[model samples]
Target chain A: MTLSLDLSHRFQGFTLEAAFTAPPGVTALFGRSGSGKTTLVNAVAGLLRPDRLRLSVAGEVLADTTAGIWQPAHRRRIGYVFQDARLFPHLTVRQNLLYGRWFAPKSPEAAQDFDRIVALLGIGGLLQRRPGALSGGERQRVALGRAILSQPRILLMDEPLAALDEARKAEILPYLEQLRDELGLPILYVSHSMAEVARLATTVVLLEAGRVTAAGPVAVMLAQPEHAQSLGLREAGAVLQGQIAAQEEDGLTRISTEAGPLWLPRVAGEPGRPLRLRILAQDVMLALQAPQGLSALNHFESVVEAVHLGDGPGAMVRLRAGDAAVLARITARSAKAMGLRPGLRLHAVLKAVSVAQENIGRGA
Target chain B: MTLSLRVSAVATVVSLPLGIAVALALARGRFPGRQLLNGLVHLPLILPPVVTGYLLLLTFGRKGWVGQWLDQWFGLVFAFRWTGAALAAAIMAFPLMVRAIRLAIEAVDPKLEQAAATLGAGRFMVFLTVTLPLILPGILAGTILAFAKAMGEFGATITFVSNIPGQTQTLPSAIYAYMQVPGGDAQAARLVLVAIVIAMAALLLSEWISRAVARRIAGT
Candidate 1:
């Protein structure tokens, strides 16, 4: 299902005007703090009535200010998983998980299997315990289970992992990926962490100062030179979707992407399982020709698509290799000496160790 | 003592629901005249006990406006009766009831109520399933305070419903009556000791109940 929103709202000293269409899968609203990501999600969830809005999910109109059509939050059937989980403290985990089911519309299609949801969230062990007795990650898991049991048409997750420690975030991310692959539900996820965006988002909507700066498939948006400043140069990179081709000897794996085959440190997934690789711009090196004397395990022949000169001595070069895009950040002096411009052919080299294990993740 | 217990218990049980409703309005409602309603509910607490009793007598006595209609329509009477004493006690204790309950409701996070809404609960269901259980400690505290105040009510109960033996004479009224007659000092002293013990028990009971409720609700 596709979700579209054109909304405008004014808060104290800030105005949010955003419009974007999120296709099926996870559409991430990515931005720095105060970029109105939460406001946009709140508008979609009917938590905030914007000054002007026209929102629709899968062609069903949720809000239209000009037409005077507004649905209250309870009737919207859109589940929200907040950053803090918001579980009922007065209830045991099982009761909290089933709280929404009591009010769900009575219909076969709206009914979710109780045992299956509990098993899926791995919260069966926590059923008898209250929220105060659960760990932060456990609380979030129960919160997810509660929202899923509500049978929402769409799910809005506002930085659900933002409050967790690194280990806790790691613990929950796999469950999220599993949900994305199996639930068949569209998700609008909000986050400022690019690493998270690169790992989970099928589509990325970049917001800056309450405006949608760019919106497109994650792979395309990540490689655009124009988005370098908004994405924060240190975290700016390209996301390549590929499937594991084979497990090679010497603790290495080969993956095939649109660009070409890539060899990296061994990953745990079986052959044919899709993997998303996050290649940071700082990890990429550019050469006029393929170097035979280097230890880098990955190389791509590409033509420069665009050159973005930074205010400092650095520069970002956008490149197109086959059908996939790659980004390489180098010194401005090198660009001037190499006469880098659109259509100039070059080689992109990447060391195997530069791609950290954390940067590689399973894809839906 | 049995008459006093019955009067106070009846007054508290009858006013409990109304007290909760009024407390919710005071804690959450934002419409016009809220301040006026708050002041009116609290007037009996600040006013002289005799004045409050006189007002109750004027409104609910046999010859008064509501009292005349009630007697003519339903043949009910409050003037110089035990029911009238219960009414006076309830009115006298209403402020303490509302204050404790309102503070409890205010302490509850409205965000939890909003979360309940997102989970498909309407306003009434949200209150029943979320707000009520969370504010139980406050309600218990308020009810105990009101019950204690009603048990000790003397001036207002005597004014609205004259202290008739076996009918309108509550514990405090009986103590006052005994103190008035020669050689009745011993009986008055015994009743005073009983009153002190009841008051202390109510206080300790409230403290224990509130702590247990707090611990259960807090899940700690």
Candidate 2:
């Protein structure tokens, strides 16, 4: 299924004009705060009326301002999981989960399997409790269940984990991944964290100041040197699709990537399980020649594809390793000294310990 | 006492839906005539009770426009009847009821309502399931206040419906009637004590009900 949206709205200080079509899977709207991610999602949910909008999900027209057809939110059948879990304070968790069913369209396909949803969210224990009593993660789980029980045509999540603490986020991320994998539901996930986008998104639509700067598959988008600037210099990175090749006897796991075999601290997974690794540009170093006696475990022979110089002393160099892309941030002085240019071959070195466990996820 | 209770109860019950409607509108609506509607709802509180009664007399009295239609068609007369006392009391207590309910409604977070809508609930369903349940404390407080105001309403009741024993004579009117006769002081004093007792009981009952409902809604 595909979800397409084209909308333009002028606020007091900001104007949003964004259009993108997302294929099935998690399409993340990635931007900084006030970049209009939430506004775009709200317009799609029918909560906000834009000056001009045309939105449809899997061939069903949700809104068309030109035709004077603006479906009310209740009839749109689009589920929204808000940043703050807005569960009914007066109802028990079970009631809140079942609330959407009360007004849901009466059809066999619209009916959600209650037992399966509760089990999927692991909220069966919370059924007797109220929202005020649930922890943040539990509340979010209940909210997710409530939205799913509505049998929406599509799901819109607006920074669902932004309100949680690190521990709570860790507690909830696995459930989100399960939803993404098992539900087969088209999810528009909004977030500002590069780590989340790298871990969860199948596609990324980069937003900058209310405009969509770039949109493409996750691996390709994150590797673009121009797009890295908009993704924040600190978060500039490339995603590598790899598989667990072996677990060595010396407390290390080998991952086979297009670049080459990468050895990292042992990660929990069976051999041959696909994994996505986010290698931040800042964490990579370049050598003009294959260096000797290097402590770093990862060394990939690559050719420099492009050099993007920042305003400061640093420069971001994009390299192609076989079919994969890798980014390295080095001082301009070093780039000048090495005569770095497109098509120049070099070695990309990385310390295995610099790869945070938080930036790794099971890939599709 | 039975007539007083019946009149006040009917008035409180009758005006409740209108009070909630007006309160929700005042708290949530952004219409052009919002301030005018607010002022009109509150006019009875600022105007003299006698003048309010006179206005009611002009509109709902037997010979008045609405009252004439009611009398000719439905035989429902508001002038000099207990129903008129209830109507007058409802009008006088309306502002207080709306004020309490409006404050309660304003205290509710609109985001919860939006969430309900996204869950496929329509406007009225959202109000019924989310808004009304959340504001039960305010509704209880408003209803008790209106009931207490109706029980004690005398100036308007006496002016429009007059002090007719067993019909329009409420607690305050009965007390007023007893005060004008010799040796009626003891009876008037007794009624005064009853009024105080009933008012205190109503206040305590309202407090208990609201606290219970608040605790339930708050999940405390």
Candidate 3:
């Protein structure tokens, strides 16, 4: 099931007009702050009516301004997990979770079992406690459970983890992954955190100002230099599709990709289980000739596809190694010295430890 | 003292729903004349009590327009009667109640209501299940304030209903009546102590209730 949005809304000093489809699985609306991601999500949830909208969940049309058809938010069956959790402080956690269930008619398939969700979110201990007593992460988890119990056709999470610290965000991620794989429910996740989007989103819609600058499969979207530049040099990276091949005794795991077998720090995936690794652009270095390894364990023979020069001394080099697309960030001086241009045969080198544990996630 | 208690309690109860409705409108409504409505509700707070009383008498006297209409239809009258004392007290206390409740409503996060709406709750349901309960402590404080004000109201009550013994006489009016005659200091002094006791008890009860409600909502 997919949620499609083609809407336009005018705001003072800013206008948000976007059209994008949230494909099955986690489709992330990735953008920096003040990019209007939340407002777009609100339009999908029917909380904010856009000036013009044609939104549908699965095949049911929730709103189409031109068609003169609109549904009120309460009847739309969209489960929204806000950034702040927004849990009713007066109600116990159990009551908060069950609050929405009372209003939604449950089909056998849509009816998420109460105890199972409590277990899924690990919130059974908080059932009797009010929202005020829960920590930030716990509150968000309860909010997610509450939204699910409402039996929504699709889930809309607007930067639900944005308020949490890194540790708290890490704590909630595994549960979110489990929700994606187990529930088979499509979700529209909005976030400025590229790491979260890279880890969870199967599809990426990059929003800038109030418009979608790019949209595609996560792997393709991550390779786009336009959004990569906007994401800043630190988060600019490419995702490599690979499967774990072996676990070396020296605490390194072998992952086989189309490019070649690469060794990295031990990951949790079992042998033969596929995984996605995000190699930062800066972590990769380009060599004009076959480079002898000093300490870098991974280097691939590749051809330069594009060179994007930044305003400063830095440049992003897009390379094609076998079937994989690798990105290398280097100084413009080196590119000019090496005459790095499209179709130039070269080597893309990477430090194995440079791919931090946070940069790796299980395959979708 | 019993008459005073009855008048204040009756006044508070009668005006509770209206007070909440008006407060909600003042806090959230954006309709035309909203400012005018706010100013009118607060007129009794700033205007001299006697002036407010005079206006009420003109509007609700036995032969007054609304009073005559009510008398003919509902057979209800508020002239020189205990009911008149209650009406005058309610008017005098309206602004305090509305102000407290409005502040509470403003303190509530509208984001919670939006969350409820996404959960399939309509506007009214959101209010009943979330907004109303979340603001429960505020509402109680507002009610207690209004009741206290009603208990102490003398000028408006006297001018509107007059201090008729056993009928329109409340605590403050009775105290004033005692002071008007010589050698009635003992009665007036005793009533003054009674008023202090009643006010103290009310303050203590409100404190306890506020603490209990706050603890429940805050989960401390």
Candidate 4:
């Protein structure tokens, strides 16, 4: 399934003109606030009418202004998970989850059994509770499950995690990854956090001042020097898809990455499960020589692919570790001292504990 | 006092739905003459109570346009009768009820109603289930205020339909009748106290109900 949006909307001082085709995966609309991310998603959700909108999801035309075909939000079959998780206060969790089902078209062949959704969202324990009783993370999870139960062709999430604290965000992201891999649902996720985009998105659409700055696979787009500047050079990194190999006795979990095996502080998942881990550029260090003894647990031999210089003080070095690429944010002085350039071999060391636990997820 | 209470009850029951409609229209609907409609709704409030009664009498007298049609078709009468007094009180209190309701409806988050719409509720369904329930506290408050106003309505009722004992003699009209008669001060004073107590009690009751409902609906 694919979603396409060719829309132009003008709101106050902001003018948004963006056109992109998002493939069946998690496409992160990454940008700063007031950069038209929410506006673009709202247009797709039919919450806002653009000046010109020609949008389709899975070949279904939701809006075509030229043809005068505009489907109201309910008929669009596009589920939207709002940032606030606007659950009905009067309804129980069970009732809230089924709120959209009454509007969904009859599907004799594709019935979404309610029990399955309850279990999938892990709301079985709190089915009778009201939304006010649930924590922020739990409310968001229920919101997502409610959207999914309606059986949407595509889901539009407008910063679903923005309302949660760091712990709440960590609590919900695994389920999100599970939804992405398990359901095959095309998701349009809007967020300002580059870390979230790197961890969850297969495709990233970068927006700046309401225009498309870049759009492509997450790996290639994020590796670009221009993209790094927008995402902050310190936050730039590569996302590695790995699987849980085993849990070591020393409180470290080992994962098999494309580069080889990487051991990180213990993750709470079973062996052999897929995981997506983000190695932040700042957490990685480059060594001119293969160090004899280093306390850091992760070290991979990589050849310098490109060195990108920012305005002052720092440079971003891209390296190819086996078939995978990783980034390191090193100072200009260090880059010169280490004689770092394209085609130079170096060892990249990363502290096991410095990698945020939230960035570690189970990758297929 | 009892007659006035009955008149207030009947008028409130009759005009509650109309008040809600007018309020919603003012809060959400846009039309060519919306400002004119708004002004017209408040005319009874701004006019002298006697002038409003005179207008009601002109429009709804037995020989008047609407009164004539009603009498011919349905044997309905609002001319110099208890019903005419109720109508006068309703008109006089209509603006107060509508203002409260309109403010409440405006305070409702349109996004919540939109959320309900996207949940597969039709427009009417959304209003009935979501919008109406959320604004019910306001409706209750408005009804109580209008009822209190109607109970104390004397000028419009007496002008439209003379203060006939047990017929159109509401609380205020009864008090007025007592004041005009010889040796009737005590009776009028008793009725005045009853009216004040009822108004205070109704206000308190509405406040309690609104707070309880706001808690349940908004969960704040």
What residue pairs are clashing in model 1? none
Q: Each prediction's DockQ? A: 0.71, 0.80, 0.83, 0.42
- The digit string of per-residue lDDT tens for model 2 on A1-364 reads 7899999999987999999998888899999999999999999998999999999999988899999989999999999999999999999999999999999877675435888889888988888888888989999999999998998888999999999999999888878877887788889999999888887888999999999999999989988888877888888888887878999999999988878889988878879777778888988999998979878878899999999998899999999998899888889999999999999999999753233222234223
Question: DockQ order of candidates, best first?
Answer: 3, 2, 1, 4
lDDT of 3 by residue, A262-345 (tens): 988887767977666788888888887777746788888999999998888998888888898887888999999999989999
**Docking quality tier of model 4:** acceptable
How many angstroms is residue A66 displaced in model 1 relative to the true structure, after the best TM-score fit? 1.9
Per-residue error (Å), model 1, residue A30? 1.5
How would the docking of model 3 be graded?
high
Best by DockQ: 3
> Could you tell me how far off, in angstroms, the CA of residue B191 lies in candidate 3 after the best superposition?
1.6
Residue B190 in candidate 2 has what lDDT?
Answer: 97
User: Model 2, clash count?
Assistant: 0
Candidate 2 chain B, poorest ten consecutive residues by summed lDDT: B211-220
* The 10-residue segment with the lowest total lDDT in model 1 chain A: A353-362
B144-167 in candidate 3: lDDT tens per residue? 989999999988999999999999
Score candidate 2 by TM-score against the native: 0.96
The weakest ten consecutive residues by lDDT in model 3 chain B span B130-139
